[model samples]
Target: MVCCSLENNDVGWFSRRQSAYQCTTPITASQSCGGLLARIRPTILQIPPIHAPSFMALRRDTLVEAVEFPIHLESIERYFTMTDRRECAFCASEITEINDSKEHVIPNSIGGRKKVRGFICITCNSSFGQSWDAKLAEQLNWFSLAVGIEREQGSCPAKIVHTVDGTELRLRADGTMTRKEPFFQKTESDGKVNIRMLASTKREAQQRLKGIKKEHPGFDLEGELKNLERTAFKVNSALQHRLELGGSEAGRSVVKTAIAQCVRLGIAAHRCEIGIYTLKTPTDDRGFALFYIRDVVIDRPQTDLFHLVSIRGDSEKGTLLAYVEYFGAMRVMVNLSSKFEGDSFISVYAFNPQSREELNLSVNWDIPATELHAAFNGFGLDANNFYLACRNATAIAYHMQKMRERHHVHREELSAVLSQLGIPPGGIPEPKDRDQFNSLMEEKLGSLSEFIKKIPPMPDD
Candidate 1:
């Protein structure tokens, strides 16, 4: 028989047995326990307790994808090492330590969150903190691009008509004239006047009246009537020509088609004026198409002014389209408001959704800088001065760095450099009085450096 006992010390309890088979050595509790266990049937061996398997692996897989903050060990490590305690991503000022908080590479308001990765910095995060739902960067980019394209194209062609009682005149070819008369009537009144007037052209009638005027200085009645007829004829002719050129069916059709395309692309149309008898229809996406018809005949004279029309359209689908209705009749003119006169061409910007930002991607057709400067003058800002200052800043920075290595410092030389940059003699601020300017330059450089650091290392490929 085997006995089993529990013990608290190093020496185990021993069984009280002395025989040829019994050993005299102290039997450890383990040994006693083993003997007892051995006495049990071999088929019924004792077994150790079992524990439940860990679910940590499954939990990690389930949570990593959905959690916005650092969820996995690798990400957490990266957060601490790369972004946690960085400076403001945009402004580049050190504020917190790395690992203090997760910086959003993209701001949350613009559909960016911690899960998206590598878009936000601490300062930018705070600046845009909780201010989500601002216009998406993509939309801004699109708008900027659209505005630029339109500005470059100048104003779209429009058909305008102005009509006066018993007369209609149209201005065409920038300035041309055509005359059409429905009827001509001469009535004789038996007053104290006994004079017959007949001439081949209106100019001949005027010449005849001028001779009569010299003989009878006070005989202004015939001259006044002749002047009236000439004026009416000229006005009528001008109006007819304009209508023939601008208010034609073909012109209307071209405009209609262009407008339809703009509408489909989600662009807005402003001040669109088609010729009379033009056909127009709405676009599926939300715009209009116009068709010019020249079938209508107008005996009366009229004049028209096709003013600027503002167009808005969808950029993603390329909605806006422009074509010459009458190639010769259409002329694009950019109005120079006093402020923007010198700016011959304005910059257009487009919003990029992928970059989540706006970029000035293109310029209107090349315009002279002088024109743009004149344009800006209307705005009460000294554009020339501003331009010179900007140019000087760049020149100064470049030359200062170039001369630094040579250890040459000359105010006169610097002033000459400023002049080359278009700055007047006294435009540049003195170095001793330029603390703010220096700080601004340093801040800009710092931001650029920080931005470079945030860029991911290039891949081998």
Candidate 2:
């Protein structure tokens, strides 16, 4: 994580501050670790003035050695923020504000917000319900179930897959899950014991109920067994039916998933400057189920609700990009159509039925776009992991283009800068070359002449 400012006291000292730091000494502790700290303890502050102070004296050696530093400051003037009604991040259509409009960043089906602090015009919002958001939810169906998140009742219905015997079937929340067990008794038979299982479902029980008369006309068994086994089966069926998880026939409501995403990326920004990135959900078997859904019977079980949503943004990164991380596990990124303006962390709206709390964190956007970046101190998000894991020339081409266009530079110029960076072209570097690649990319981004201060976006409201 890097906090950039050209306001050092020793301004116009070295070619770039990065070079000055490279020339300084090493230390065990970081300058930015503990917040509310006004200064690095002086004991460890001997490294250099290049760090620590917003202003400092240039080392005589640095002033005498490196080439002349640029005379410009990297301060941004505008800050991008989200608004009530704005353009769609997906369709590029204008979204008008209305009384009923609500955008869920994670989507209502996945236990996301119903009224996130931003908006995704109703049109594009609806389209996403029919398309992108739905597919995203589909991709994460298992995790959602494991997390015990619920879907909005009506328009955004849950797609539940239940396995019976060897077959997999899709189900909506309106009906019940039925399983039958057949119980029959035989009085002292020919030195043998018999066991039978009854109806696995209501329909099957009703269908199988007709056979008691034909099969046992001569047997006389009163007590609870007096009735045809079918009658007893019906009673068991009523008690055994498993009602769906998220109640049935929920009211029709607009989902706010994409809008929540927009808020996370600072939708207050202008549309065109934001960048969007989508990553494939990881498929692996690890950890145990977050919550278990079972039959609601005697000693009733409490459904543990784990519906949490967080919208983290980096407004200082110039381009507003969203990073969706599910706890410390799953992650996704959506670049809004705008630029972020200042240092901001994640704005979390956690819906825990057991507790109520509020949280705010601050993060720097100038940090390296590493695959292991975490939004907050313990967010456990690697925003670029999956994106880089499956990196191809085309996956990042659009954002690269946006970066190029934003700088008003040609590809060759960018390549030349990248080359001088000592970082190889493209972003992938083999494991053995990881450290080298990181150093090079840092150099490339740090020393570019055309790389001016990042500009934040302005709100449309």
Candidate 3:
């Protein structure tokens, strides 16, 4: 049997028996009670406090992910070099003040390893970090909670508001959840679960009822008491759905992060806004807002995390396209150029589920750019003709074959969509001539304006 004692001799910092105790540090012992014959005064016993260095030895009681407190960049010194390029990558404004602040090509809060020197000035960096970057972290943090993905945050507990029994309760804890003044506690002995309420006393409960009655004046105290008594021993309960009280910040950050990579790669500042994936199906399409990129970029991290910034281009595909896709996770590919404003050159490219690599510049696979310009009210281009004007027919046929298989989409559906596209169905006809496909596709696209003109003309009412 193990036993211990808090003897009076070990009560003070200056006590003779203090050395007998394993605890150190100054402790002010409470005043001692006199002898039994003397006044009845209590002596306070001081327990040894566990210092910070010993925290690791304690066992955790709960399992949860670690998340950092939102990162705050204060008066951090501006550092990092800039390219000879004089324009800010984001706003496309002139970067006159070059030496004031440094920019992290990837955000630093969520463990961004790489840094970019300049091209994005300090003011812009700080602004984006506070607004856009903060938004990204919150989205990530919520994702962490929703999926139970553990995050790392030193030794402090992360504050998360989660739903409990359809009610929102804020949980603050590390891997070991801790709560103060819990109204009830639970214990499992046999196969069943149990909840033990900690009501102080019958009188105390009555006082609470009386207080409620006094506050509301019209409350039915007796009826409430009867209901409480009826449910006093009830134990079964079920958890319904959870309603997250958060804002949407996933898709935009993917674009922002990708843009940062473009800025780093020496893409002209104004050209950063080359294309934007349609925001119509933002969340389902873009990412778990791309938290997994962190996993791909870093060593084993706390979750499927972060986004990648891949910016590349070739001359054959005349129009730029930007879109994001999701399967097990989400990734984005975009044309990191702003050629839309100067000349009309645009195309819409779908993210291929099989195409894991970032830059797949298929000259034959593209959509008309004027479509998006019309959709986004112009800030776009038209690239279908530019690419068709330089397409390789065999390669086009091969690319279409791959797309058809990868999507498990029927060839009929493909033909139907292409028919609407006004491109010749002959372009994708039965496998015969190696060189005839491009001509057929061109023949179809050539009569596009005439076909548009010959259509029913909206039928004069």
Per-residue accuracy of model 3 over 37-145 as CA lDDT, tens digit each: 1111112222233222211232222111121212111101111123445665544456664452445544444334445544566665666544655655553332232
Error of 1 at 74 (Å): 44
lDDT sort, best first:
3, 2, 1
Q: After superposition, how far is residue 19 of candidate 3 from its true place, in Å?
A: 32
- The local distance difference test score of model 2 is 0.31
What C-alpha lDDT does candidate 1 achieve relative to the native structure? 0.25
Regions of model 1 farther than 4 Å from truth: 1-193, 196-204, 209-306, 309-315, 321-461
> On residues 1-461, what C-alpha lDDT tens digit does candidate 2 reach at each position?
11111100000111110112221221122221111111222122222222322101334344333423121111212344543355555554565556224665555555554455334456645644445455545443433432334465643343433222222222222221122223344454686433243443334434443454356564333321322121110111001011111100010011134235445555542342322221111221010111111111122112222333333444454433333333222333333333445555554443432122232322233333321122111122221221121111111221222233334323433444445444477644568766765675455445333222211121111
**Residue 167 CA error for candidate 2 (Å)?**
6.3
lDDT of each: 0.25, 0.31, 0.31
Report how far residue 211 has shifted in candidate 3, in Å: 27
Candidate 2: lDDT of 204?
46
Rank candidates by TM-score, best first. 2, 3, 1
Q: Please provide TM-scores, in order, for all candidate models, with all chains considered together.
A: 0.15, 0.37, 0.34
Q: Mind giving the per-residue lDDT tens digits that candidate 1 earns over 414-461? A: 443444444577787567546754564454344233322222221111
- Residue 308 lDDT, candidate 2, scale 0-100: 38
After aligning candidate 3 to the native by TM-score, how far in Å is the CA of 385 from where it should be? 32
